[model samples]
Target: MAEEKLPTRAEDFAEWYNQLVVRADLADYAPVRGCMVVKPYGWALWENITSWLDGEFKKTGHVNAAFPTLIPMSFFEKEKEHVEGFAPELAVVTHGGGVELEEKLAVRPTSETIIGHMYSKWVKSWRDLPLLIVQWGSVLRWEMRTKLFLRTTEFYWHEGHTAHVSEEEAKEEMYRILDIYERFCFEEAAIPVLKGTKSETERFAGAQITTSIEAMMWDKRALQSGTSHYFGDNFAKAFEIQFLNKDNKLTFAQTTSWAISSRIIGAMIMVHGDDNGLVLPPRLAPIQAVVVPIFKNDAEKEKVMEVADRIFAELKTAGIRIKMDDRDNVSSGFKFNDWEMRGVPVRVEIGPKDVEKGSVALARRDKPGREGKTFVPQAGLDSAVSDLLADIQASLLKRATEYRDANIHNVEDFEELKQVVQDGWAFSYWCESRECETKVKEEAKATTRNIPFNQPDTEGTCVVCGKPSKRKAYFAKAY
Candidate 1:
């Protein structure tokens, strides 16, 4: 079978993304509609993310716990706004053992209701005021328009839920988690993002405020990478989660929920992937460095494999995820392309001649062509590989940030906003009214991404309604 070349991203970004994902052995469409079979490589990437975030959660006094995937319909109904928001996407189980259920069960879309119910039962006094728990599980949302990992019907994610005695504590937890999410995007995923509170219409249902980290993809579309919501006393009151205070007075608990999903994999693909294939960050790449032995005959193979094996062992001992490609049947060029397609951070090629010189040729995935390929001595190869991988990780984030910053435009009118959003992000003063937000969306197919928290304070008229504006909002077409 012949290998397929991915469509050029510049010509057709969507097709390019779809092809690269499968071609690179990340994931594939599942037998069920709107679902994806996350391949082993894809799962490994997710595992790396899960392990890191799980540690962060633990460090912040949060512990892992499991919640039932099946939530009673009555539980969802306890919170009217949440039920209304998730009703359309809920996958209800009406029957069990061939008998109709008395009350339908919903496959978990988000675990707020079930978790809230559990919290209400567990909390009774001020001593149990702060309940911090994290659930790593799959959620089913019946998305009408699915796009692999980005919008799959069943997606893997971690939802963090907490209960506090005071509203200030809940808000603090929300921002703390949001800061961690922003850090993960920039430090681990090599994607730069804007962090801020979502507009009223864009806030999560039943949330008093929603804060998110939004990233710009290569196509100039926004991707909501992760979100943290402050629910105040809304869900606690609805679910009857109450606690007696130090003063011996009962009050509703303040609640917060924050989540990050497999959709981040899609963001990484769009941000760093090129026409050749994926360009993974060193921190998350399943195989950080791959050793491809170059040989033309058995004699050459014996010489190259010896060095390749040694280098692989050394890198492994150095705590790097390294692989040695010693298959004699495959050509060296084929192995190179295979590793490149997989987005291994560094490729070390050891050939007979290079071995004779006591050195190895190194190539980086983030840079184009032979320009990124260099020769390093075998004596200090471990440090060389480490330095190169670090450079690649930093460079990818730098490149993405440059692209995102250059494309963001400040516009004063709706027409300018529409024109700017066609290619990139539009920053304009917004009236903070749903009517103006809806008009912008209906007219330009763009929505306010967020009201950036750190943007400078300025006074101007609304881009849509010409009304007095409270703050500048980012408007962009999003994934």
Candidate 2:
């Protein structure tokens, strides 16, 4: 069969993304428009994500639960602003069992509405101050623009909702979830992110504060990896989620919720993938390392298999996700292309020449710029491959950090801010006026994405209106 070729990233970024997702055998468009069918490889990657994220949620004292997919329209109206913001995107069901229903139920655009209704009932006393619940499931939104995992009609995500006694505690909880999300994406996924709070106009519906961890894609567009909301009694008041305090006073409790979805899968593809295909981090890669046993003929096949099986067994015992390529129909060159396309962090090739020479060839998928890969001696192949995986993980993070640093810049004026925002993040002094925020967005096509946590008051005029500055806002054109 002929090799299927696709558009190069330089040819067109959008085309490159679409080609990579399908060509890598990750996902396919389902019969439903704007929705995708995650193939085995893509689902396996998501399984890896949920496994790690669920463990983190458990470590943070959150319990997992399932919620019904369809929610009553009345439940959505409980939160006033929430309903208005989400009403347009909702997919509602008006009939059940071929009969018209009295009240229409909407497929959850987000679980906040349904979950808020449950939260009201789940709490009644001071003892229920902190009701932490998490759910992992698929959600539907009538999306107009869909790009595989980037933006889909139906996508899987793990959302966490926590209720608390006061706004102070809720803020802390919001930041805590942000920390967990940052750790998961940056540390495990090897994607660098910028931590900041979104501007009022960009904040989540009904949230007092919205904090996000934003990562820039290879296309220079920002991908919102995860978001945490500090809802200060807004949902509680709407849904009547009140509890008796220690002094027997009825108070509307505070709530916070956060989520990281399969969107990270899209971010991962854009950040690390190349013309070849997806380059997943070793820690998150479905197959960390693939052993491609090179054999010249039948004389060497049995011996190579013995060595390959031994290496695979050792890695498996070490709790590594490993694969061994033992097919006889394909040549070593074809196997190399296949594994590289899948972006296995490490590939070990052992053949008759290496078996006789007591050395094996090792290849790092990332270091292609090094001309060619170096060999791993038989006595040291196992240890060397382990070290290579670690190096690849660290190298990817370092590369992305440099990209982030290069893209993020401080702008002194409107023109400077406009140019900076086109490429990446621009931290500029803002007058803290809603009008100026709107102006920046209107003229530059960039919004006030966030007010960074670490930024202190500075002596500078507003980048847009040249008024007294309130905060240094990070502006960017987002996904």
What are the clash counts of all predictions, listed in order? Answer: 0, 0
TM-score of 1: 0.98
The C-alpha TM-scores of every prediction are 0.98, 0.97
| C-alpha local distance difference test of each model | 0.92, 0.85
Q: Encode model 2's per-residue lDDT on 1-479: one tens digit a residue.
A: 24555567879889988878887888999998998999999889999988999999899899999999999988888777888888999999999999999999999988887888888998999798799999999999898898899999998898899899888888999999999999998889999987888888888888989999988888777888999999998988888899999999999989999999999999999999887778999888899888889887777888888877887787777677889889988998878877777778888888888778777778888864234377767675566777888999999999998988888888878998888787778888888788988888788898877777887655688988898876787788888
List candidate 2 stretches off by more than 4 Å. Answer: 1-3, 369-372
Candidate 1: 10-residue stretch with minimal lDDT: 1-10
For residues 134-177, write the lDDT of model 1, one tens digit per residue.
99999999999999889999999999999998989999999999
